[model samples]
Target: MTSYNASLRARLMPIGLLLIAMSCIQGGASLATSLFPAVGPATATSLRLIMAALILWAIFRPWRWRVARRDWRDLLLYGIAMGSMNFLLYQAINHIPLGIAVALEFTGPLGVALWSSKSRFDLLWIAIAIAGLAVLLGLDHGNSDHTINLTGVLCALGAGGCWAAYILFGQRAGEVNGMQSAVWGITIAAVVIAPIGLVNAAPAITESHVLLIALCVALLSTALPYTLEMVALPRLPTQTFGTLMSLEPAFGALSGLLFLGQALSLLQWLAIMAVVTASIGTTVTGRSAEPIEAPYPD
Candidate 1:
């Protein structure tokens, strides 16, 4: 009985880690919204990526690791995808609520999961997801303040597309040590986002408070979650990991409500639930095409 209990604990620990990682990431995103006024979203994104890269590189010393020449293509793609995804997501949350933006962005991965499926049941899930999105975007909730922003929705969708690319390229790049690959990938992302951020909000980026908040965002959104996910992924089955990750939108909603005071209406809540169900169904049905290395949301 003692040996069995120990084995069960070991198995459960990774799931707990993944849940903690998702919560940290969603909470971090809510916190980041508070920084947008002080340092524009672009600048905040740049700072977060730069700080995350610095921390990861310091810990992993990716520079000390040798990379195969063949891996460079995938690494570059992964970095570009990561940078674009973060930048776009920040832009999205600036205009939309965190939970809604996350739900929209999740469609990218959902699309990937459905892309390879020949099952009729997958179509049902797809239709259900579309209905959820329609309700999310089109339903008259009787509050004029609840109107959806088309541009923000587009930005979230763009981020989702980039996320799909990240998953694909990450799979190839992740053949290297997880920490090392993350360091290099995040560093490259920082480099890519730097020029745009500087051009848009150079002076704001220099503020002491902005720097502090950016560092916190980096630790909460990237470093901690990435570390936890890396630890969890190898231990959990892909289906279990994906199902757990499906809770991210709900987590985002809760964090937004708690930290940002962004509340969802009943219809919106139903929409979120619909999307969540689709995601969970996809995972449970084994149609999810997620990478073995879990994707990180910033």
Candidate 2:
């Protein structure tokens, strides 16, 4: 390829990968809802992780490979973070609207991204994001049901914090290849939840349809997009990757509507756009101080 085409391809690759990753996230939610009627968020999240771990382990056979002890530790930490983050976020979603839960959970990354803002422009972005969140809280119209559930919001925020940690540990885990890190990390997560998963997974496993759905969820939610991201990460800048990830909430809202018939209120939709715009505005135009690498192998 020519130099210009190569550069274009480099840029486009990340975009395409990110798009697919977001689609997977959206698909995950839809699939979970379809698989388990009235399923609690914790159960759904646990099942997804378990299924993903099984699939990855079967394919990679990380036992046959080797990795550094320090890297193994990083993967374990990343897996713990992933497990906790998913559990809390799903808990939030059970109480609140999925879109709102996702938006709230995004604050963790946004906060990390905005941590070093010496400029008024950074403050402006923060203000914009806060405004968007305020709209999301729906305090103006004084609709009680529309108001966010405090516990749920807190859980979402906790999930966001875990997500930020996941990102941090993920970089360390991704340093070496062959997906050994992912395998170990996911194994750690599954082990951590083994007690609860045993109780919840048994019922689903017994049902052939649920088993099929769980496998589908694992592929769409965890495997496919994660692989795509691993491929695109080296090609994209840290800020660019963060900006692309910011589009996840938008994709989630869209997917919820299309796949699960979960519609957002006009206010909620606007709120999602507001946070998304702020996140994009901050990342796409601004430079990230730290470089972030993808966590898994594509």
Q: Best candidate per lDDT, number?
A: 1
- Would you list the C-alpha lDDT of every candidate in the order shown? 0.84, 0.74
Estimate the overall C-alpha local distance difference test score of candidate 2.
0.74
Could you give candidate 2's per-residue lDDT for residues 1-298 as a string of tens digits?
A: 6999999987797888888888887778667766445445566666778888888888778888777776777888888987888778767766776777788888877776677434346877788889888887776578786878888888987988988888778878767763677777777887775556556553545677776787788888777776777788778777777777888778777877887677888888998988998888777655556655445211
TM-score of 1: 0.94
- Which regions in candidate 2 have their CA more than 4 angstroms from the true location? 1-11, 116-120, 176-178, 200-205, 294-298
Instruction: Identify the leading candidate in terms of TM-score.
Output: 1
Each model's TM-score? 0.94, 0.87
